[model samples]
Target chain A: MREDKKTPSVRKLRVRKSHIKTRLVLFLLLTAALMLTVIFAQQICPYDPNAQDTSISLQPPSLEHLAGTDRFGRDMFSRILVGLQTSVLSTLCLVVIITVAGTAAGILCGYYGGILDSVVMRISDVCLAFPGLVFALAIASLLGGGLHNAVFALAVISWPKYARIARSQTLSVKNTDYISAARLAGGNSIQIIIRHVLPNSIGPILVTSMLDIGTMLMELAGLSFLGLGAQPPTAELGNMMSGGRSMLQTYPWVIIGPGIAIFAAVVIFNLLGDTFRDYLDPRNSRRN
Target chain B: MEPILTADNLTKIFDEKGKEKFTAVDHISFQLYPGETLGIVGESGSGKSTLAKMISRLTDITEGNLFLCGKEITRVKGKALRRAYEDIQMVFQSPAASFDPRRTLGDGIGESLRNHGVSKVNVQKEAVRLLKECGLSPEFADRYPHEVSGGQCQRAAIARALAIRPKILICDEATSALDVTVQQQIMELLGRMREEREIACIFICHNLGLVQSFCDRLLVMYEGKIVEEGTPDEVIKNPRSDYTKELIEAVL
Candidate 1:
């Protein structure tokens, strides 16, 4: 083999090592901190987030009561932290469900494009026509207000986008010579679909999945703000924001605490997803 | 002698939305005997690739029958269809795309064997042995497709096809992607392997010069039909069909 003429230079690999180092550190640090806030909610917080005391109700940011206390005298700091945990867990569950459903739909339609593809795509198109938040709200209100119903309704509306992305990616890769090679090598349909088709189609699916996380967090927060998510007195971030809205000027810290949590969650996930897409991009990898 | 591979009245029609349609491969027939190299030479859209795809069962035949190593394989499915690969194997023009980029070259070479019930421990050893036989260093197996030259990748692809010990090997423009020198090297390698194993080969290419030197017999195709057939020397020396005459004249 002509090593000097054709081999991909090893210098690029060296550059890639440093690139991964910073990305791994930042992604892990943010995710770990978020996980810790959820896992050690009570141990770290000095007061019960739900235990309201009307005596010290109208307070602002201070050492004795971080993020101040609401009109109900609930500690906004503890509520926001705990609310971050709830959003993350519920979103994780929804992502898992949506990924499974969407990836399966995409692969099946993509690999076996015919009447099955037409039917599946038609269904996905119908689902996608409904605006995401409005559809989730309609379903949540129909299912009755609860965090779980909100998550489920959101999942129902969200999977089609992933499915559409996955389907298009799969269709593009389906007829490639490598896939034909896989088939001629005695790989059965299922094995070829799972091993060859899915792996090749995963890049777009992953990028979209990351982007969807940010969108879902926003949708979940909005649902709760509309009083359809985690019920009152539970200290959910969106619910706290909703509760603090009416008394915005009187106790600004109450809205500010949970507001920052929601903003941070969306920004952190979106940035991580952007970094991940850039990392996985083949053109960028080639440069490295 | 019984033919190793036979195609009778093969055809492929492409339908566009059930309204506008055209026949890609018209009725064509051929037979390949063990130890024979049959060259299919045609211009683009002459259905050479489509014909090869039908023989390998990569695409369904619209109307025809294929008998590979004494088994009818026109409509087989599941395990039987998979087992048909034992008798018929194919090498593609673009060797880079023939391999899964996610896997090491060795893993790709050994994949067919693994499907054939070869043990995991034996696969690596078998793959290395196959690579060496194809005039490559065993270490080449560990390298990814991107790390190797086009010539090297074609060699590895040949090694993969040869690993299965198929009775009939179909190479569809297998060396067209390489340089003159590399193409000669691969042709020589295939010549050696054919002599050693007595495997029937269906060589599809647009290069009339290479076909004349390498293949024993020739089938000239035009619009999916075999317009002429004979020994490559006869076909080149005394061209019969007008199309064949034009093809030979263009190359010479």
Candidate 2:
């Protein structure tokens, strides 16, 4: 009787585990595909992304150019491939910077929580109070237009979100018995934070960063659209789209190509982030 | 003979500057001699846990002097504080909660040994051995805290505390979260360890019956003060304080 009752639950658990595994595998494969495309983008492009040809300017999609030619006569398909490489890679770089910097600052602040914490958190509060894109625009304009400056500006604004998540997670984990046990086990502050605090608090931060990928991508593209990011001949998706904006009615292929690339990238990352959140949640992961 | 641990008028005020200042533990003092099980019992919110926290140095002592092995450790910080932990260890109320959810039970058990300079290879072996010693299977070392039953996790917690070979072990309601049968088993294990190692222990709990059987000396606390103190038999038989009588009556 007991075996009969337990068998269904065991089966349910197995089903759930497989479901999570498949989702995780799909997400990883898609992310890897994006990364690989970014890595081999230059090699894969049929024509130089920045090369100009007045003879083929404003040409429609055809056998020669898959995404047609922009007003500047740059092959839309080639520009998009390289442009994807730039946009995705830079977004990844920006995410890494903000996640690392924010998590570090937050852990230190949440753990120690005195003068340094107060100062740093207040600064983050100020950063968070403003509209994110507007603040980034202000900083980007101040720093002058470039891919690096745009990333820096976005990073300056976006990091607080991760910091807030990390700080709150840290604060909640700080008082748990495991942390106290680590302390009683003779672990120094650094050891305790690394072993006990960071691992426990990292779930929410990771989820936040995963979800932020889509947002960051859109924001980066937005900056480029506003003429505050990735300059001419850079082959960034946003820049490509921005350059083709004037010719959108006349040569819709140019704008649509980069638009589709951005849309696909955003959707993939958002779905990956959703799956990551589901997998990371302990309620769903309790194998016992 | 000197005491293994001493708390001189330990106090803990929750808020420093506020309209409402609450004293969780108020002017409490006690001493634990070597090779003795000192039981601290009180009703809920009587500051038994707070007193335990102060003695273990997990929570800051608002106003008091804590002397471990006759050295004043009222305000020690950093390296010195970590050094102090080698001599003093704690098993908290919830066994599962005390072990890091992300880490294996073996990792939590071996953590102290690793932190105190034990080699990586030896730490694993020692952790398995400790698990076995605590009445758990060697395989339990690899399991996460939530994977095991509460009793098994408490046994792992006990193993972790004993790993450091500390002179003083503070059990802050360590077995309160377990079932009666499991509690009895844990009590028996603790009794055997006390005889074998002669490790001084501060066992904090609210269960009067358990304290009577397990403790060598009992301190009955009420409103953060040690209202009564004696051998468990003496206190239960001839209670000096009204709170002690009330506690005994409540148990009956």
Candidate 3:
């Protein structure tokens, strides 16, 4: 067999630097934009999200109202910004809870592969059989409508997909020679799962988690639209759109502002998730 | 010479629903003496690999007694089983898929030592020395499995198995995945190491010719049973079992 004399140090270094730089820039930009929106929400608005001015009610976009005024004379622009915070926060919470819980359950189910595996998978399958929205609504109604309740509902509904994916990946990884080698080397079941199985299975789990974040955001917005999520005066994008549907002909900015924010957030998250999927795939890197 | 390891009436049955129950290893018995290589030759599904696994305690013996160093290891579990593993290690067929891709080669080798409570500093030193001894560079310690060639990875695997200083090294088609040239090199390395360390080895393979040259004694398995067993010369030159004759004729 011929061994290559030249070390791939320079090539590897270049690939590493470029990959990290791209991810770092994208992460920083997204984080900064989200932070700036929260910090400047109060300063930029001419009126509060709940402030009512009857005289300027239903006003179109102008110098006084940047995104026009709603039927209640509340600034559409301000409400959208505040709603961004609520939507972002609730979605963030739902994503974290679902991913962590789902991935953990999936990993355990996949690694063990016996009675626990069967039971956990059956539960996940049952949860998955229900329409996500209807399931979340049923859960939210039972728990009583609020931001936390909606987040909890969405998380409960969203976790099964992650769990299933994680379980399958774990099952495949657990049988690999390394896991057997670890077992032979005196590693316990937990050690084999944690050290051998989890690390190998994490790539797919991470990709799924990233993709799930966007779905969770959309689900949260849908709940808010149905009045099962953030309450009035809380400044949620879905709630703002729902409140603006009646006077959409007179002041279109009420719907357009929140709609654009939701679109941008979803697109950015999807793009970031795609980038991660490509990066994590060894085949993709090998080709480059 | 007395046998260091022995298996009596070893059998493994697989229950496939609706289909007839399959016996992989059927009442197979073998003994491995110190400082000897017992080559188990068979076709695929002949249960040679299964028998090797049972002897190494990598898999449980379905209906048999396996004595390791004169101790009945069939019922061993937990710490006792682990102690048995320290004295008996296995090298698998696929070196590429054997080591955890996420960890460095050093970590994979060090894992065996760490589990047996070997000192941390000594593990590293031993890991490096073992890697070098197996014809791998010391720099291989920091690299992942994908970063190295298949032969190199297999060498690292052998090194990892040797890290615990196993008395009996089990090579389960260890050189099957390598190229012809690399195969000879690995076979030579294994033979030299066996002599140097006075380790008993159970070399399981389908290739009768390859093992005949390296192994002192040969065990020919057919349909989960040891059809014949004798010195390589007797098995290769004056084979009694029809299956063994067919195997040698096909290979030679």
RMSD of each predicted structure: 3.6, 2.3, 4.5
Clash-forming residue pairs, model 3 = A83-A235
Give stretches of model 1 more than 4 Å off.
A1-24
Relative to the true structure, candidate 3 has a C-alpha RMSD (angstroms) of 4.5
lDDT of 3 at A53: 79
Query: By DockQ, highest first, what's the ranking?
Result: 2, 1, 3
Candidate 2 local Cα displacement, residue A227, angstroms: 1.2
For the predicted complex of model 3, DockQ is 0.59
* Candidate 1 per-residue C-alpha lDDT over A53-121 given as tens digits, one digit per residue, 9 for 90 to 100: 999887888998878888877777777777888887788788878988999998898888899999988
User: Candidate 2 DockQ category?
Assistant: high
Give the per-residue Cα lDDT of candidate 2 at A45: 88
Error of 3 at B19 (Å): 3.2
Pick the DockQ winner: 2
Best by lDDT: 2
Chain B TM-score against the true chain B, each candidate: 0.98, 0.97, 0.96
Candidate 3 per-residue lDDT over residues B39-149, each given as its tens digit = 999999899888877876777777988888789999788788888887889999999899998889999999988877889899889899998899988899999998899
Each model's C-alpha lDDT?
Answer: 0.87, 0.90, 0.85
